[model samples]
Target chain A: MKSVPNRILLLLSLLGFASALTIVFYPLFKKPIHTSVASSMRLKIPRIGIDAAVESVGTSPDGAMDVPQNLDDVAWFNLGPRPGAVGSAVIDGHSGWSHGIPAVFDNLYTIQKGDTILVQDQNGITTTFVVRDVKTYDPKANASAVFTSSDGKTHLNLITCTGPWSAIQKTHVSRLVVFSDMEK
Target chain B: MVIVTMVMTMLASFASPLIASAATTPSLGSAATYGILSSTYTNTTAGTTINGDVGFTTGPALLPGGTHNNYGSGSPYATAGSDQANALSNINNQACTFTFAPGAIDLATDTTHGTIGVYTPGVYCTSGPGAASIGTAGIILSGIGTYIFKIDGALTSVANSAVTLQGASACDVFWAPTQATTLGADSTFVGTNIDASGITLESNVGWKGQALAFGGTVTTVVDDTITVPSCTSQTPIPGGSGTAGTISGGCLWTGPNPCSSYGPQPQKIQIAPVAIAAVPVPVATLPNTGLPPDTKNNTSSVIIISSLSALLLITYIVRGRKIS
Candidate 1:
């Protein structure tokens, strides 16, 4: 009779050991993902103190994407997929004024790694993104990374004029683009 | 057909080394034209001499007492006049495309020259509120490589803010400042300076490259010397076969008569190892125990729970043996 009880205790201890092991290992396994595609309507970045409405824009007659006339407003490439969609979406703003004044993205260069970027769509759904990389491109260079479609994952690229001002061209010398990946 | 294919493959194998060697130097397009170019006006004090052309296309103004040699229609600059415009455009286009080194030291907040080290060819930038200042100890750029310093903010040089070069040239160094760029008195500098707003060369600054202000304005104090690197010696062959210098030791400053102290002189500096990114812990290779990687926080809890269960099992077994 004692042996029976002892055996039951041993079985219970084994079950307890297995449960403890499972609890410890659960996080190592890949977690299930909950993701969806939605049209981005508003963008917010608390770290950068940016909360702005997004406007849809298309390519201009010169084959370049049209820019927002208002410096504060950000223009999104309308021809591409929405921000939370299965591909890359682009948004751009002015970093400085033609007269050497500060523009909307004057402080955008202050962003750091691991900061969160929130994008809300017309449907009221929000997608969160984590910054992965920040890069600057010459105004006249070809930047396929900011525009090209990527089916592998969803990304959001924010761009603005940066670098030295060109008196001859009356424009910034380079463009600064911040790349973020959608958080799972 | 088989023999021809084999021969072609052999030729390609032999050419691989040549191609690899040629890839090190990046091309600077039309940007190489001016030793010093300004859009509005160029102002200089007496005794300021420029070896290359001094141009202000927009304002067509240059301050008196500064001599500009080796530019304009009669000068020997390779890309002068109309060709220079294209070269500037080319440099503006290509310069931004290159990959800047990661974790570039923030030299802006450090108004006082604090950084001292040897840097390799790559884009160094300052994104902070304060302008980037080349600290007092100065910086040594090593290797015959291209170096681009892009300051989105303003740029200030303290006195004796020296820029020493190893195997580099004035033509290969580029300084792009978004706002005002001021060189302190008696500061030594290298590279073509493309300042957007304006540039003020403090008294007696020794500049070894072009000082260009896109807005067409450059202000130089008394006794500032600007030497433009010569085109014949500055231009690198397409195949990277020959350099611009034919001097016995190395290519000295480019000009009809090379300046004695103007070229890159050898310097000793401690080169820091390139920063390596942290590798993520592998999940797939973990033993099928299905637990998260044994990080310190996770391991602590796991060990406690495991220890408790093991103790209970041992107690049960010991008690059972005693009873038996």
Candidate 2:
């Protein structure tokens, strides 16, 4: 009889442990989203822990989109609704050149759908985003606004290279983007 | 009856003591006959004059615009010359020197300088490296004991060329093509550098975007004294007054925002200018560029959801006995 009660208690404890584990890892998989502050945080590109190459390239109005040589090459700025609003948040780096990671967006294309991304802001806070879609675009193409959602939805659109490598310009004609959404 | 009629007639003829007395000295914008400096003037508050240079205690005001205005000093400036401004056009086609018409404009009196017409038809700034034919050399204001370089024009940067702000005073500006509506009366594009320093959207001045977007960039000079506020979700309006200004959509100031939400970093605004001070450099001592305003919607909703989740978690744990 005692064994039976103890067994019941053990099962309950295990169930509780599983629940706790689910809640703990929920942010990495499925987590509750709070639009208020989550959407309010600035969606920053450039992961907090990842070390990116800083390149130096000439300046252009189109900005260092496909090609960048240094931190100066990549025009760093914000585009999300607020700083850390959910949805797909994006920060673009140069892909043409670099010293460490060389390509501004070399790893961007490597990011598979459902991958997790964290954006750290000026307050040392991190807003997480998960990859959802990856789209490719051409430089001359006027489709950069794809990252912007019409319904006040915030998203990060990352731009980079894809397809067979080219020798003439050294890269492909079209650009690939890894689209992510706020992990909810 | 005749006396009464005369009095009424005189009143009508005299009008209400009108201030219009001085006829315009010159046509507002482009000069006739191929001129050296061509520009445009766009003013949201019609009749706000782009005074020629304010009287400087020292030498000539840099670009013949205005003078000695500091940040938040309420110094009025001219608008981006609407049509298209070719300050030193043909720098590529022709051999002409172009300088960013001075900005430290302080409209002590209603004045006008540079050009007086529409400028740069299409976008943010007149797109060009002047065709790269303009060469790398650019205008530079070397010395100063307080001077002004007023520009009611867009200082567009070429491929190799850049517009440099070297004055020691606040270069008050009134308009940018994207932020101010007067530039694009019937347009459907977003203007670049809307966040350019000294830019403010007054009385719904520059509100239109490609599709109702807010968030333009402005560059501000920093100093050791600038404070870096903690990042928060709080959106503080630009000016102290509520009605006068707004937190329009989203804004990213050079300094850190204390009301930031989520994960924000310690954006040290003063660091930019302060870091340069250590270099013992001249212009290097100043912060080079600035940030643009960020945007979107749904941010508030997302925040709400985050709050509720936290509350639920707190309540569940607090109300229930300890579940080891």
Candidate 3:
């Protein structure tokens, strides 16, 4: 009877050890979720632990897509279709350090394909989006595809500055874009 | 009184046909091949497709997707620029058959053609310091002749507005604006717009003629399609198959020559010059979304996950030791 109780404890400890190992390496084998959202007021990337506010923005004086003034927030291009609309809706965020604080998209480059992005609106309804592609572009590259979509499906694209910094230009040399599609 | 009424009706009918005379068509010359001709052409989105040639003199013309003969300050480009200047001058010098004073002018409703907005071949002028606008109701070009619109100020069209052609050719339509010309989003415009101040096209604007901006930039946003009208003898007159008569110059038409009848000229309205509001030009660059480099790394999640894993492992080891 004593041996039987000891065996049960041994099996339980072994099971616990296996569970801990799996938990540690779970991200490596995890499959990505494919989904998308509508009429966004907030952007949530559960994988990177980002839950940031979204602000509406237009073209800047220099005719570029404007970014949010706040480091913690993302700016949605209001001139284009709204998030979850038929066309491609663009949102831009700041990356790098802002006054010793991490900006909203500091870890944007770490986002992987198939990640789930959630957009929540004022009505408390949440829309989900799945990552389709991640691309890098030159600073002077024609980024029309980021703002326009002809497939007649709702799309959301997130943009952030990546690559090497240009001290003279006061901006990044390249841009990182995350293209997502609204879940059907 | 009955005789007087019959005579008045006869006079009105006769006067209607003589309201507008055919305006002279200015030759585009080498500029005819270009859908977009400017000193600098700037396009933001990759969706813009120019069906004809695109020429620029001073350019970093960032056009990514389009099937066209792209020219930069050489050969036909320089010739096209000169031809555009000449065409602009010719159109500007043409006498106005009807002029509308600036404030609150809609081409569809405010013109002499009244609510019908059907304009015959003539030179129409909007004497401004004020702007002229085409509302959503739009306007129709009715006959086969040169139709020139001379706006001393800015010209803008509302979204979804269409410049419809009835029995006219798109090639014969010219818009000469002294200031900037803005075609609103998704608006379908049919004309050869010659502007000294610049041309800005909003998203999805479908233009069937040329955007010739002399000494100015031509800026296009997302998904604008500009096709240079190929004016050939076989150009079909939409509703002019049966009753349509051929003019002496081989131009086919459906209606009577408006200038053939005798009538008094229409009164022209002159408005005081108002100062035009300057439109902001779009610069060709992407947004600046990067911050300065930081030494601090954002690895809070990684730290947390690793710590949790270590704790789980420690717990399992301690429990196993106790069990043993």
Best by DockQ: 3
lDDT of 3 at B53: 70
Model 2, span B197-270: residue lDDT tens:
22322221111111111122211111101111111222232322211112233233433223212112324221
TM-score rank, highest first?
Answer: 3, 1, 2
* DockQ values, each candidate: 0.05, 0.02, 0.14
Q: TM-scores of all models? A: 0.37, 0.29, 0.45
lDDT of 1 by residue, B1-324 (tens): 999999999998787544333212223333344556655444423356666555543221122333343222112222333444443443444433233233323342332232335766555554443356776777787775556676666777888778888987666777766678888888999877767578888899998887766444677767788887754533322222211212122322322112112223323223322322211111110000011112213556667777877876887888867979
lDDT of 3 by residue, A1-184 (tens): 2344544545655565566556545534654211111212689999998888776566767778887767788877755555765567788888887434678898999999999998875445677899999999887788788877666577999999998888888888999999999988
lDDT of 1 by residue, A25-106 (tens): 6645634221111213578889888876665555565556666544455666644545875556777765643222244566
Question: Which prediction has the highest TM-score against the true structure?
Answer: 3
Error of 3 at B172 (Å): 0.2
| Steric overlap count per candidate | 16, 83, 8
Model 2 C-alpha lDDT versus the unseen true structure: 0.29
Which residue segments of model 3 deviate by more than 4 Å?
Answer: A1-184, B1-21, B58-64, B102-104, B232-324
Relative to the unseen true structure, what is the C-alpha lDDT of residue A106 in candidate 2, on a scale of 0 to 100?
Answer: 44
lDDT of 2 by residue, A52-91 (tens): 3222112234433223323222322222222244222334
